[model samples]
Target chain A: MFECLFEQASLLKKICEAIKELTDQACFEVSGTGISLQAMDSSHVSLVSFLLRNEHFSQFRCDRNLTLGLNLKMITKILKTAGNEDRVTLRAEDDGDHLVMVIESKTGNKISSYEVKMLDIDQQAFGVNETDYKASTKMSSEEFQRICHDLLVVGDTVSIEMTKDGITFSVSGTETSGCITCRQSGTVDDESVGTEITLQEPMNLSFALKFLNLFTKATPLSNSVSIEMSADQPLCIHYDIGDMGNIRYFLAPKIDDEEGAGAAGAPAAAPTEAAGGDDE
Target chain B: MGIKHLMQVILENAPDAVVENPVPSYFGRVIGIDASMALYQFLIAVRVEGQQLTNDKGEVTSHLMGMFTRTTKMMAAGLRPVYVFDGRPPEAKQNELARRHEVREDAKEKEAEAKEAGDQAEMERFSRRQVRVNQQHCDEAKRLLTLMGIPYIEAPGEAEAQCAALCRAGKIWATGSEDMDSLCFGSPILLRNLTFSEARKLPIREVHLDQVIAGLGLTMPQFVDFCILCGCDYCGTIKGIGEKNALKLIKRWGTIEQALEHLDKTKFPLPESFNYQQARALFQQPEVLDPARVDLRWGQPDEEGLVQFLVGEKQFAEDRVRATTARLRASKQTATQSRLEQFMGPPAIMTSCSAPPGPWPMVQGPIVLTPSPFPPLRQQAGAAAAEKGNKKARTSAKGAKGAAKATATKPAAKKR
Candidate 1:
C-alpha cells in the first residue's frame, strides 16, 4: 500500500499541469525516499525527471516501492476539479488496478474521492547524471519563456552561444532575424531567486525553440529557471519548486541540418560583452 | 456488419470502460481503419438523390471521394491512418455473408418497386441498403492510399480481426471502425466516431479492452464466450437470449458450455445450427498479417502523383485536388516538431525521414507503438532496423565530412 498527502491542492495541480505538457502517461516511482518520475516525451527528444522528497508532503507513507503508472492528462483533469484550498491525498494498493484520490475542503465540510485506473506503462529510465556543464545560466522564468516564445516566430530553432562575455540566444529566419543575449549579473540566489551565469569552456548549440517554450510551462511553479548545457549530454532546464524539490527537463540538441548550421553561425551577430542586466 | 447491440451493452454495463475524447483530439497518432466498412458507409451516405456519385465514365467515385476527403482531413489534423482491407472471408463468416446476400436481394426488389412507384426517397433508402463493397472498391481504395502516400495492409481474413491484432501488436494506437467486433477480437483500443467527424458531433469514444474486462468482472476468455453468446456474425445465436440475458448468464455461469447446461431449452430454444465453441475459437485467434513484416511510414504525400491520379485519371475537380494536396504537403513542413507534443497530444509519429535523427538510444518498451514519435527522425522499433542499415552504409558525405560525422556519432553510440 502507498499513500501521500499534499497540504494544499494547488501545488499538486501545478506539478501535474506542468508535466502533462511533456507526456500523456508516466510512471511515478514511489519509494521510501520520496516520489520521483523519470520519463521522456514520445519523440525521445526530451526527457522530464523530478523527485518530490518525502518530507515535502504533509503525510507520506509507503511499505514498499511502487511504480504508479498513470495518465498524466487524467490526473491533471481530476486535480482541476478540486478547489485550490482543498487538501489532496492519493492512496493506492500494491497490486491494485487503480489509484484512489481523496480531496477535502480546507474547512473539512466537503470531501470527494476519485478512482482512476492504472495503466501498464513500462518506461525505461535513461540515466541522466549531473554533468560538469560547459555553461550554466540562471534567468527569470518569465524572461526565458518570452525569449523562447518570441524567437519561435523568427525560426523553428534558437542558437544558444555561451562565451566569456555572456550567454547569447539568437535566431535567423529566411526573412527575419533576431537575437537576445543575457550577461552575468546578481547572484542567482541559492534559494534560486536571482539571475546569474557561470561559463567554463564556451559552448554553442542549436535547440528546438518549441521545446524550450514547453519547458517554460513550469514557470508558474518557480520564479527562476536554470539551464545547463554540455557537449556530451542533453541540455537540462531546472525549476526548483520552492524548498520541496526541483523538476528538470532534458532536451537533446538539434543535430544541425544544413539550415540549422547556418543559424548556429548567425548567433555571433548578437551584441558582444552583453553588458550586465536582465533582458526582461 | 458488427455484433448487434454489443456497443450498447458495453456502454450500459461498464461504467468507465470507454474514454470519450473530443473530436480531432488525436494528433500525430497512427490508427488502423477498417477500409471496407468505411467505403460501404461512404457508398450509403454520399449520394445525390437515388444515384451514387460517379465520374464521367459512369464508374462510381463515391468511395474515392470519401477516401480522399477523410484521409487528407485526418492527415491535416495530424492523424496517420493506415487502411486495412479484408481479403477472403473465413468459413464461419460464410453464413453471415449468405444472410447479407439475402438481405441485399430483398432490398433490390424493394428498390425496384419504389422506382416503379416514382418514390424517390424510398428508392434511395432501399438502394442504400443494397450497397456492397466489392473487390473494385477495395482496389480503388488501395490505389488512392498509395497515391496519397499512406500505407495499407491486406488482411487474410476479416479486417476487423486484423485491425485488432495490429492494435494488440502495438502497430497502431487503436482499431478504428464502427464495428464492435474489434472489441471481441481483443484490440487494446477501439476508436469509434472516427470517420465523417463533421457530421458526428459526438466525441470520439475509445474503448479499452483491458478496462472493459476489469469493469465487467470477466477474464478475456469469458469475454469471448460472452460475445459469442451475445450473438456474433459468424454463427446463430440462442433464440431468446440477447445482449442483456447473455451478460447475466455469462456472469452467472462463467462459460457458454455451463450456461447451455443451466439454460431452459423449453422456454428459450436454440438456433437452427449453433456452434458457439467454433465462433468463440474464431474470435480468440483470427488470421492476420504478421505485424513485424508490415512497414509503416508517413511519407510526405506525393503531391504530383496525387494530382495526376485524382485529376488527370479520375476526373476529380483540379482545384479541389490541388487545394487538398497543398494541405497534405503543408503537414510535412510542420509535421510535429519532434519534441514536446508527442507526449502531450499523441504518443508517436511514424518516421517521416526528412530531418537528422537525434542522438538517443532507441530505448524500447516491450511493445513499441507505431506512429512511434518524431516525424522526421527514424525513431521506432521497426525503424531501428532500418537505421541499422544506414549505420552500416555510412551515408555521410565523403572524406572530411564523413570522418567528422563518425567522430561526432561515436561517443553518443557508446554512451547509450
Candidate 2:
C-alpha cells in the first residue's frame, strides 16, 4: 500500500554504505511525509538517521505509514544490482511481510524486482531534532573528508574548537600533534565552496576520528557537509542530499581525555543524556 | 483440575495461610516434588524461543533438560529434592482426567488453526495449553533422575497425595508444586512456584494447611468438604458457582452435601455425575506409600552415566553436562557435602541461572543461548503427521525464552 520511487539507485547505495559501518540492520519508517530510518549501532555508541522526503521522488504514493526492519547489507546488495541511473522503486503492502523493490532502467526497457524478507525488530528508534547548538559550521564535503582522513594518521581523536573567527580541527597523538583551522569565508558564489561559522559561545569538543571518517562515506552524494556541536553533547555530522532530505550521524563526544583521548570515547552517552535515553 | 481458583480464594479469605517469601526457609531441606506437574512445567518452559527442545530421535527432551539443570541448581543452593512420581489416577478422578484430555484435544485443534493462520502468539499459547506428561515423559525424567542420583518414589495414586502424606510424615519439609490442589490432599506445607527457576525472583509462596484451617475457621473435615465445593481433580462441581461463591456456600452449609441439597438447582445446575462423596474420601484417605518405610536419600550422581544419557543420547551440550557434574562434585560437604566436595571443586554450572526468562514463548522471547544460537529445527507437535509439512514460519520467533509466567491462582477456566 506504501511505495516510494527514488530516481537514482545510487542514493540508496550511498545511504546504505554510510550506515553499514554504524549498524547492520535499521528500521525504515515509511509514511506519507517520506521514508526515514534511525538506528543505533549494537554498541550504542554512535547513531545514524536519514530522511528522504516525498518531493525527492519522481512518483510517490503512500496509503498508510509502515515500519520495515530491513537488513542494510541486504539492501546494499539489492541496490548493487541496479545501475547508478536506474529508477528504483520501493513498495510494501500494509500488513504484508516483504518489502517489494522494483528497479527500472532509465530507458524503461528493462526492469528487475526483489522481495526482501522483513524482520520483527522490537527496539524503538530514537528521534533527533534541531537543538540549540553551541557552534555550527558548514564546509565543502571534500574539505571535511580530507580533514577527517588527514587527521587519522596524526592521532586517534580530533579535538574540534569553534569560535567567532572559524572552526579548528586539532589532533595530538603520542609523538605528534596537528591542527587544521578553516577561516570563515566573507562571500562566495557557491554554497559548496563557501565556509560559514555560527557560534553562540566558543566550544571545544573531542570525537573519535574513525567515526568521523566513516561519516564521510556520504561525501559523494553531496558537495557540502554541516557540523553541529554543543557542550557535553554528541557531535552531529550532516550531508544534505540535494534539497530532498538529509543523512545525519551523531557521535558522542570524548569525555575525560581532552587533547589526546586514548581510545574511542568508551561509547559515552554524556551528550545523549539531554537528547533523551532513546538514543542509547 | 487444581481446585480451580482455590489458591486465590484461600489467599483472598485467609492471607495468613500463605508465606510471602519462603526462599531462605528451603535451604538444606528435602522438598517433595509432584513429579508429573514438574515435568509438565519443564516441557512447557525449556522451549528455545517457542520451539520444543528435542533429541535427534525426535523424542522431546525438554523435561530431562529442565530436570537435570534445575535439580543440579537446587542441590548447588543446598536443597534436598525428593521427586515423587504419579502411579495411577483414582477411580473417582477418571471423569476429571477425561475432561482434561478433551481440553488438550481441543487445544491441539486450536493450535493447528493458529498455525495455519501464522498467529505465533496464539500458537504458543495453545502449545503450552497442550502440556502432556505421559508415561514415556515420566520414564525419560526417571532415567535422568537416576543418572543424577536423585531419589524419587512412585506414588500409589496421586503424586500430590503422596507429597502431602510424605510432608505429614516429616519425610519431606514441604510439597513443591504449582497445583493449588496440593492443599486439597491436606499437605501441611504446599509450596508453589518451585517448578520455575529461582533466579526469576518469584518468592516461593508457601501454603500452611493448619493456618488455612484456622484462618477459615473450619475443622479439618469441613475444610476437606470446602475444597470439594471449590472443585478438585476428583470430580466436577455445580456450574455457574465460582470459588468465592462456593466458599460462601461451604461456610453456610458446612458440607457440599448440605449445600447441594439446600441450593436451588435451576440457576446453578449440578453436574449429573457429581460424585462429591468419593472425592471427599479420596482427599481424606489418599492411597500413598507409608512415609515411615520410605527411604528418602540423596546419593552420588553417576557422572559417566549422566554425560552418556544426556549428551551422547539426548544431544545436550557436553560441556554443560561436565559443568553440572563439576558443581555436583563441589556441593558435597556434609556426609552428602563431602561426597559432593570429594568429587570436585567449585564450578557452579547450571545454565538455567543465565538462561533467559525461558520457555514461556510469549511475543518476542529472546534468551542468549550458549551452546548454539538455534538448535536443529524442532519437530512439530504431531511430529509424525507434520514432518513433511513445510517448516512453520519461526520468523517472529524469539525475545526472552524464560519462565516469566507465574501460573498463579487465576480463574480463566470458569468461562468454559
Write down the C-alpha DockQ for each prediction. Answer: 0.04, 0.02
Local accuracy of candidate 2 as per-residue lDDT tens digits, A105-153: 9999999989998775543333233457889998898999999999999
Candidate 2: tens digits of C-alpha lDDT, residues B1-416: 58777777788778968876546445556899989988998899889889789999999999988898888878776677888888778998788788889999999999999999999999999999898998888877777776676778788788899899989888898999888778878889988887796668787788899888888878888888888877778878778887777778878988887888889999888888888888888988989878877765455677888888889989999999999987864443321111111111111111111112222112121222222211111111112113323122121111101111111111111110
i-RMS of candidate 2: 27.0
Q: What is the lDDT of residue B134 in candidate 1?
A: 90
Off by over 4 Å in 1: A1-136, A154-223, A228-236, A240-280, B23-25, B47-52, B112-123, B199-202, B333-416
Error of 2 at B12 (Å): 1.6
Pairs that clash in candidate 1: B348-B371, B348-B373, B349-B371, B349-B373
Candidate 2 off by > 4 Å: A1-280, B22-24, B334-416
In candidate 1 chain A, what residue range of length 10 has the lowest lDDT sum?
A269-278
Residue-level lDDT for A122 in candidate 1: 41
Per-model chain B TM-scores are 0.80, 0.78
RMSD for all candidates, in order, please: 16.5, 22.7
State the lDDT of candidate 1 residue by residue for B214-256, as single tens digits: 8788999998888888888888988889988988999999999
